[model samples]
Target: MSRRAAGVILLAISAFLTGVKYITASIYSTSSPNSGYGADSFKQWLDYVEGNLTTYSMIVLIAGIIYLILAEIDDFDKK
Candidate 1:
């Protein structure tokens, strides 16, 4: 519908994703080598995620920004 509405929706999605990322990264993570930082297993993705708070935030922000940019581009192309 409107750019404002789309922006708000994107922001909400970003916030949700970012919150999940942070919660799993911080509270759900561990410090022991047998837990979050073991020398093997796929659970390390969780630890990696925990170590990249800024990255997750940037991803969220990038999503909103990409939406904004696409909206602007569409408007420009419509001219």
Candidate 2:
């Protein structure tokens, strides 16, 4: 696949992952008030999500952007 296509795919995947992260967080957060058991559980969940999904989403987003930029530069150089 072309760099542009790869970049678009990566960006779409990153966006979907981010949306899932936020939606899951919101759903969990609203299910119970943040206190005692609920608060602790939420904290743990947040930590896990931030460590894994959030990290990967950011990396993918950045990589996608970088790929687009590089593709543009390559096109510019060609011209």
Candidate 3:
């Protein structure tokens, strides 16, 4: 696949993951006791979700930057 296509797909995946994280957090917050205060399970869940989100977001950002650079190079080559 092209850089642009890969970038778009990465962005879409990142967005979807973010949305899912938000929903999960919301649900946990509402159902848990005072937003998982003093709870080991809640802390673990939060940590897991946060780690995944951060990893995916970083991947998306890096892919997007690479895509932009590739596009710029293509443009320069044409000029």
Candidate 4:
């Protein structure tokens, strides 16, 4: 695929991952207040999400940025 296409795909994936992260964070915040769970459990869940999903989101975001830069460079090269 072309650099522009790859960049677009990476950006789309990053956006989706970001949306998921926001939804998960909102769910955790809204539910934590009403739940009878202990603080430790909440902390553990937060840690787990941060370690896994959040990490993937960050990686995807970085990759998207890289792809975008490459696309820009490719455009420049063609000029």
Candidate 5:
């Protein structure tokens, strides 16, 4: 496939994963509807989840870069 098409597919996959994460989190939230305490707890959980997502995304990005670099080196060696 073309590089542009591969990029678009990866982007779409990432978006789909993000949407699923958000929807699942929403469905699992058991916080009270009228309690500020519950809201505070839920907010903390949301913050933690967001932080984790950011960290995982960064790791994945770095891994992809590494793979691309290695692939390029391997291709150059083949010429």
Candidate 6:
């Protein structure tokens, strides 16, 4: 409803998504053969997942944090 509420929702959603991504990546790593010999490694898969999914969520998280900060600043100015 409000900017603060929206920011809180976004923050929660981003946190949830990030947590889900880690769970998914862990499951994926276990199922796949991610040997660190060449290109396929658990770290690489995690990086890929982070780039594909978590990156956007991270951006949203940052945006939400900024929004919260701005809201606090605005409220402080009003008082």
TM-score of each: 0.44, 0.72, 0.61, 0.63, 0.46, 0.72
Using lDDT as the measure, which candidate wins? 2
| Greater-lDDT candidate between 1 and 4 | 4
Per residue, candidate 6 scores C-alpha lDDT tens digits across 1-79 of 7679888998998989888887876777777764444335657667757775777798889989988988898889999
Q: How many residue pairs clash in each candidate?
A: 0, 0, 0, 0, 0, 0
In candidate 1, which residue pairs get closer than 3 Å at backbone N, Cα or C atoms, i.e. clash?
Answer: none
* Candidate 5 Cα misplacement greater than 4 A, ranges: 30-41, 45-79
Q: Give the Å shift of residue 29 in candidate 3.
A: 1.2
Query: Which residue pairs clash within candidate 4?
Result: none
Could you arrange the candidates by lDDT from highest to lowest? Answer: 2, 6, 4, 3, 1, 5
Each model's lDDT: 0.65, 0.81, 0.71, 0.72, 0.56, 0.79
User: RMSD for each model, in Å, please?
Assistant: 6.7, 3.7, 4.2, 4.1, 5.4, 3.4
Q: How big is the positional error of residue 56 in model 3, measured in Å on the Cα after superposition?
A: 2.0
Instruction: Give the per-residue lDDT digits (tens) of candidate 5, residues 4-56.
Output: 44445555555655665565555546544643445666565566457556565
Q: Could you give candidate 4's per-residue lDDT for residues 1-79 as a string of tens digits?
A: 9767787887788788867765675568557766546666655556646656667777877887888898898889989
Mind sharing the TM-score for model 6? 0.72
Residue-wise C-alpha lDDT for candidate 2, range 20-66, written one tens digit per residue: 88677656666656533566676665665665788889999999999
Tens digit of lDDT per residue, candidate 3, span 11-65?
7777887777766765675686644545676556666568677778778877877
Q: Candidate 2, 40: how far from true, in Å?
A: 13
Q: Which candidate would rank higher by TM-score, 1 or 3? A: 3
The residue-level lDDT of candidate 2 at 38 comes to 61
